[model samples]
Target chain A: MLIMKNINKIFQTADIQTHALRDFCLQVNEGDFVSVTGPSGSGKTTFLNIAGLLETFSNGEFLLDGEDVGKLNDNGRSRMRNEKIGFIFQGFNLIPDLNLYDNVDVPLRYRGFNAKERKFRIEQNLERVGLASRMKHLPSQLSGGQQQRVAIARALATDPRFLLADEPTGNLDSEMAQSVMSLLEDINQQGTTIIMVTHDAQLAQRAKRTIQVKDGKVSELENISRQHNQAIA
Target chain B: MLETGLILRALARNKIGALLIALQIALTMTIMVNAIFMIQDRQQQMQRKSGLDEKNSFYLTNTVFGQDYNIQAHLQTDLHTIRNTPGVVDAIQINAIPLSSSGWSMALQHEPGEDKDAVGTAIYMVDDHAINSMGLTLVAGANFQPEDVELRKEGQSTWPAKTIITQAFAENLYPDNWQSAVGKTVYISQTQPIQIIGIVAALQAPWNGWNGVERSMLVPFQRESKGSYYFIRTEAGRRDELMPIIEKTLAESDKKRIIRRVTTIEDTRERSYRQHNATNKILTTVVITLTLITGFGIVGLAIFSINRRTKQIGTRRALGATKGQIMRYFMMENFIISTFGIIIGCFGAVALNMWLVNTFNLSPISFQLVAFGVITLFIVGQLAVLYPARKAAMIAPATATRTI
Candidate 1:
């Protein structure tokens, strides 16, 4: 569960100040698969960053699982992010130098899991993403869809309460994107909360709920059942 | 263990960079070890005791400019006037002063008929007052008596028969039993045999550059000539006060002879070791400069690596790595490289020392100095990698999710 009240994010330069996000408010209950859609520079990623504890909001009252995120320092934020939030970036972002197993092992390592526990979690998650047979292969050796699956496995290795994904299928083909979307839906049905940011309306329609961002503000919120039917029509 | 694996994997991606840095570290360690050894040896040589009363003794070289002056009379008058001076403890005329770098040397043989093979030794021609004036300790036998003193004129054909040798020289002549050398006869040449009447505990020769510095002897003879030396010892803490006075007295005794140089024994010893000290200073400077350059090179490489891997670092950060973890990752990478270099440098250092030993006869490198070089490089590697690592740690995770 997460909540944000009147969040404001400002980017300052030498002679200009830009508002990345202003007066933004949103709430998602546990197990919700929410997709955020926005045009370029509409502050959708900024909202996701603040929600995931990766970036600080200049002015906000943000809460995740009933804890005030605004009061945590850098280290506390990192701990919160590690213990509760998993991230799937658009680029996959798997460390190229590390093999698939090591890529999935990253979050578990930061969580201070013992070797046995880390191995079990890494294998289980990689298997869940259908990549356990290729644990020794590096990210560069895999296709874009396979790399994304590895990234998902890496995010799930920590067993976080929520997943923050920014354009998770941005680089894949339609078939690969559909498979990744289905996998995310399956993960959501298993009770892991997921918030995805995407520009593709069809992909955004696959979520349980969809939020539209514009001019650094949320403009619309709708259940995706009707939107999904409308998108296919 | 996982961190190490990560470091190794990352380094494997940039093999050339890692190897370059490691080779730099190895070269630095090699130069550092050998230079430090040379400096330490030179410092030890400078600190060695010269085995003379350096604090209260001075030597003056007199060169007579006039041809008609009586050199022997002037020498006696100068010695008498110097002895009668207020602070003068004793004064004697000799052919050479200790540590003056101007002295007589000849080869000594164990038997009279031995040819082509002899132990080279410095010969000091001094009067009966030489032992007392130079504060030499007579460890065995007796000092030269007044009647034993032989005055050699300009046209003398034979050398002195009775001589006193140092303990070190005695050991060189008779290595089996040096104490037996006190009354033994040692031939200066094929037929010129001299009797060793006494043995002193220690006496260093004027030329300390060679390994035979400790092998020296004193002959009972008065050297009076235009180019002779006068060694004077004053009471404790009175040498500096008596130097100008001695020079004035000698000048007043005979105007025909000019004092070529007036200096303390301590000053002469310092002058003798000046080249050694200069070499030590130069080696120290080289070590420091090389260390700094090596450190900066590591920093530059780390910075370049970090810049190239910014996205990977950001990904790790987003995966929940703390800033400390990120910094430690970079530092661990540098540590691995430094360790590899140190391991190779150990062999390189020994090889360099072996070359030096075979080429110049230098002492072998010590294990302690090798350990010191390793530790120094380790510390410098870490320090050099620190700034770039901190920068890597500070990268925002949002950078990873950026579309580019």
Candidate 2:
């Protein structure tokens, strides 16, 4: 449900110009779990930021659910981001002063949901993430994995159509990472499109499709099932 | 409303900063209320009307410098020359002009040697023309007749038999009704009883700060001595033009006597209230300075809070908060802090006013003044918080969320 054609992103300074992304093209259909793999400074996060409508590209044609993203202003972008896109940062950026329930209630608040609707969505999402019993606990009182789960619940509270995750399990242990990955897989199976960026090859292999980025360009694209079959043949 | 709860929790995390700002606001409110009240009271006091045509009259004060000078003859000649001068309406010799802050006072009783507490009243000695010269409107009875005019020589203590008392002075003597005081005989310091032949509408004395400034009386007497005061009334809009002419005439009439001062009654009134005016100005300056300092204090605290909560702000921005929402959050935070301070300040204001009322006898603070102070603080709080809030709102969501 997303398309990008020949996207270009440039960062300019006083005496130098750097290309963060150039001639990048990608497409993902509805109900797909795609993973982006790249080294540091390879424009992976830039691509994700642009795709999520958080940053603007210099020249591009981007269509999400059949609407041109390049034509929207700041406010329009914010509305689209709030209504149709959810984000999972590597930092698990839950507002520390708020309890878990209020943390999950942030997106719903910006979405202009009434209190009853917000409450129902927050509880349901927290329950889905197995953190409903600790809704009153603060993020500081929870472990990294729990905080990430709360972030996921916050992202889901708006019932976004597309999820953009950047290193969602970067700070967790192997067991916690596996649990988060499995939860993401389950969410994707429920028909919410997810695009995850990861450095781990094993985590990237878990997705239905993987795209490798290098030198501000997409270098490879592979289907896991086809790769598995090719390896057997 | 949910934002308010969030703001409260955030403020709870920075209790010391919030309390300091609140205390500053409270102090500002207290000082502002009291200072404004004192200024208004002083302005009202200054605006009290002196029962005379102050704009069209001037006073010439002279002191006899030579030992062989004939005081009465020179006074009569100077009076005649000034009266005959162009634009001169009327002139009379008196011991002191009204609002000169230098006059005589005496205790009055209904009868000679009476045992009741005597009422204090300001005394003025003037001739038959003094009533019209000073622009005093006689409300009852009549002005002093030519036969009632008595010439008081040096060392004489007894006053004239007929006197004109102000309505305020009459009320003091006969509290039941001032009209009854007319035609009644009142004793001055166990001397000969004098009849209140007339009553004037209103006459403010020189010392207007006294509780009984309006209590004054006029007696028909030609006060000619070493020191004399000549009050000359000019035609409408002619006092300023005739001041120099009066000075030159009086100086040439008697070279032995020195013209101590030549000034208008308005100037004399201004000189009398100089201290009160100075106090009002000082209080106004203080109020302005305190308000400015409090506003700066709020600005400093708001900037500091914005800096400290930058990450939280960024997180909210990324969670789909619009720029307007971010700005409103900071504004709401400031509003809560200011409201708390104002609530505490209201009690402090009342307590301070009560102390002033008890200690200095000032008027108590009114409800309108308290509301005014509250609204002023709210406006100042919003204005002070705006710059930092706008700065916070302009932060880019992409860059802010990249802070990890």
lDDT of 2 by residue, B148-177 (tens): 888888889878898998998988888898
Q: What DockQ do you compute for every candidate structure?
A: 0.64, 0.47
Best candidate, TM-score-wise?
A: 1
Candidate 2 stretches with Cα past 4 Å from truth are: A225-233, B109-115, B171-176, B190-192
lDDT of 1 by residue, B45-71 (tens): 677666678899999888889978887
- RMSD of candidate 1 to the truth, in angstroms, is 2.2
The TM-score, computed over Cα atoms with residue i paired to residue i, of candidate 1 is: 0.95
Q: What is the C-alpha lDDT of each candidate?
A: 0.87, 0.87
Cα lDDT tens digits, model 2, A90-147, are 8888888788998888878788888899899999999999999999998999999999
Estimate TM-scores for all models. 0.95, 0.93
Where is the poorest 10-residue window by lDDT in model 2 chain B? B395-404
- Model 2 residue A158 lDDT? 93
